[model samples]
Target: MKMNKNYCFIYSLFFFVVSMFFFLFGISIGFKSMIYILEWELINLNSSSVCFSMLLDFKSMIFMSFVLFISCMIIFYSNLYMNLDYNKNRFIILVVLFVFSMMFLIISPNLMSILLGWDGLGLTSYCLVIYYQNSKSYSAGMLTILMNRVGDVCMLMSIAWMLNFGSWNYLFFYYNENLSLELNMIVFLVLLSAMTKSAQIPFSSWLPAAMAAPTPVSALVHSSTLVTAGVYLLIRFSNLIFMAEMNNYLLMIGCLTMFMAGIGANFEFDLKKIIALSTLSQLGFMMSTIGLGFPDLAFFHLLTHALFKALLFMCAGVFIHNLNNLQDIRGMGCLVNQMPFISICFNFSNLALCGMPFLAGFYSKDLILELSLMMYMNKFIFILFFMSVGLTVMYTFRLIYYTMSMDFNYNSYFILNDEELQFIIPMFFMVLMSIFGGSFLGWMMIDIPELIIMSSWSKYFVLMIMLIGGWIGFELSNLNLLMNSLYLTNKKLVFFIGNMWFMPYLSTYMMNYYFLIVGNKIFKSADSGWLEEMGSQGMKKIFDVMFKKNQNFQDVEFFIYLVSFFMWIMILFFLIIFKM
Candidate 1:
């Protein structure tokens, strides 16, 4: 225990120091508009060379710095969160490894090196997700890893496709004006890979399921860093996506993901899952922003979102810990009375999530929405965007009402308070970031002021939608028995929207069940039945009959008698001829 505590402090300080250094370096790089590439040749073949390379620019350095910083905080927080657990040392090690994997991914411009980090993330996340050593954790881990494998496969295909260009370094092609048709296909594959990683649409089931992990892991991995990897990848390849003319498709998917996750969160009861859905919605927002030809805005939102979301999860961790691991929001109410400081922090982060004015989320989110409104898009996209925005606020309001306003529904023996410095200290830093990170990041990221032209009605549209959404959320939270029955009368509708449009079912039981049925039929009709008889079994029977016939011909007595009789016949014939 002493040793583990030492390890935690040591790593925490190490990561914190390194993170500050990287942040300063990133700022300098950005100001100077500098890029540094370091490469070492691993293997050289005819006309193709594989080299390990790192791209050190403002983007990579800043992202790496943020990841490490969050990692440092989460590690310090975990020292208290996982104190009673037997394998806290192992937990800390896995987290450190996960951070390193993310760092590798952020810096690598080569697909091969990217794969190393990509696979590292997948593997470490699986280990972390299953760290609880139980059936639920095991199931969640399996689902998480399997869903992620789809993206890994897509990434591998893209890597192989890049081999056609005689190099796997994607940095060379990032700014290529005259790209070939094959490059488009590679970009398409890369897009699919990013979608799966980011949990867009059909691949989104795994994010909520990943709540099986410990809350610190949830804070660091799921909410902030791990889920954003796909968005980061797409941001890097934004130029390629535009060149391939796939931005519209990406835009469509991103919008749908936003809408779907937003709706799901409004109906979700699990505390962690609601937050997970929120993360998904924000990821979609990032994707859509990138799709609209604004990677800078997306990156801006990504960084800000990371700060608040991590804080949100950290506050949630304290709640769950105090409640004895009860994560159902229905059982929590008036928590502010017991834990005032945490409640304040939680509310601040929540409001930040809703893009409240002057908060971290507002600077990025409002800018993205306004800029998107400036773009010429169809009615479907426009409606989806607004609806998604409304739903986000609706869910946030609903969550706050259920957990903070209603009467406490848990056992009276519960002991909840804001006394843990380990938890509060990390969350406090994030709270500071959540309050001011966006404006600071905006200044650094946006080199030029964007010209957003719109009418008064258009300008006020977001505020109007948010007001309406908040009202609906309040009304829904106060639903009477009659209203509940009327609203939930169509259980099927509730089920569909509430479960991410049945993505988990499709990804798991629905898809797997059909394939298993086909496989079972094939096994029964062929392998165990007809094929068994006609294949090896029938061949064995034919061989048996041939063996029996050969046995008769090879009888020793029969062969000797036949030879003697033939010899006597030849002798008699010769004697008769001689007598004549």
Candidate 2:
């Protein structure tokens, strides 16, 4: 348990330096004109031989740049975040390994390399999640490992299927050319894997449980590295899914997950859990964009989300670290006057998260909503999208209000130390980015057609809905009785819908008929008198005869061995006679 400060500091510094190098390299590559420049051969290695390949063009460079930028921020944040922890050395090592894995994932040219990097990330993250080794943290880490392993299995099967029918090269290979029933199965399995890893729907419960880890781990895992892997997979395979025509199903699942997680966020009191659920909801939005065949939108949202969510979680860390580790929003209030700097930064990030105009989230989320509206052509999907957006604003502001509005019991003279400042500096930069990064990117010369088109009607309609929903949520917060009433109503509806329209009686009926009644009978039959006893007795007798024999048993064993030898000789004699 001895901490190694020197090792932690050195490795952290090394990771931060290397990550900046990659970021600069990616930016240079992204802006270069490959069409005008002469082609230079890049070396690529494989099992058979080393082959020459061309360097990455614009698209690959963009993703790589984003990955590097996020990796750098995460490493820099971890330097201060892990300083006081007992296992600082281990934390620094895992953080560097995580960055390396993500770098490999981004630069991978083939599915095999991507998967190799993907598994590396999963393994390192699992270890980091349980770094505390408390019972709750360990259990949460185990659940994450198990659920993600299921995703890994699905991915492996998909790879096998692809290799069997298609080529090993994931890029440039047209999946539609070899589309078949089997290929469709593989596609479904791959999508399932993406959903599980992304923490969508039924697989989402594990993410909230993962809040048992330190706040920084939650920030990194939820925002940048672990959950986003699914989004990366979908982005990489957008062409294949489009070719297979599975967008409709994907869209449905994404919409459902987004709304459900949004609603769940409304009811959460735990600050970290709320952020975790928000991460799930935002990822669902990204998946929906991918489902709608807009990988660019997904990528844009992913970038904006990482910035704001990381800031928010780090701000939460500041609050927790200041208040002696209190996580419940209800327990602490009116924090803005006390922690003015952290409050301002947290509010700026939350504004971006709430998708307020001119913030990082506005440009990306607006683009997604516009694309979803255009592609699905379903009013219901649009309605759900708006509702989720509304819920996002509601819960986010609720978090703000609960944290900064009620009361400030602590002395107003509390100050942040240098270690805290290390965490805060990155957050301040993120706040600035959340305020301006989207607009800057919007002005950049990228082919985002969705942003180019201006529809007055669509704009008015979306703005009106968002305004109304925001007002409703704001007003509801003032009326205690009405708020409780609405909570009860939503509870009933959610329970009914979640139970497949059958209320409490449905659960009772299923349990009585399927579990209690039928299960009991099956268990009774399985443990019945004659067959059960005979089986148990037979196993015991076999072991006894083999290991616990007396003189009589030894004689019998010798006779059996002599008989086996005689039989072997007789068989050999018969074979020789036949041959003669």
Please report the candidate that would top lDDT against the real structure. 1
lDDT of 1 by residue, 141-253 (tens): 99999988999999999988887777888877865555577789899989998998899987999999999999999999755577899999999999888888999999999
Q: Output the number of the TM-score-best candidate.
A: 1
Candidate 2 lDDT over residue span 223-339, tens digit each: 667788888877877887887789877877788888887777767778888888789889888887887778877887887888888888988988888777778887778777677
Model 1: how far residue 429 lies from native, Å: 0.7
Indicate the residue-level lDDT of 224 in model 1: 52
lDDT of 2 at 464: 66
Q: Give the runs in model 2 whose Cα sits over 4 Å from its true position.
A: 1-13, 32-60, 409-419, 445-455, 485-580
Error of 2 at 556 (Å): 17
What overall lDDT goes with each candidate model?
0.90, 0.72
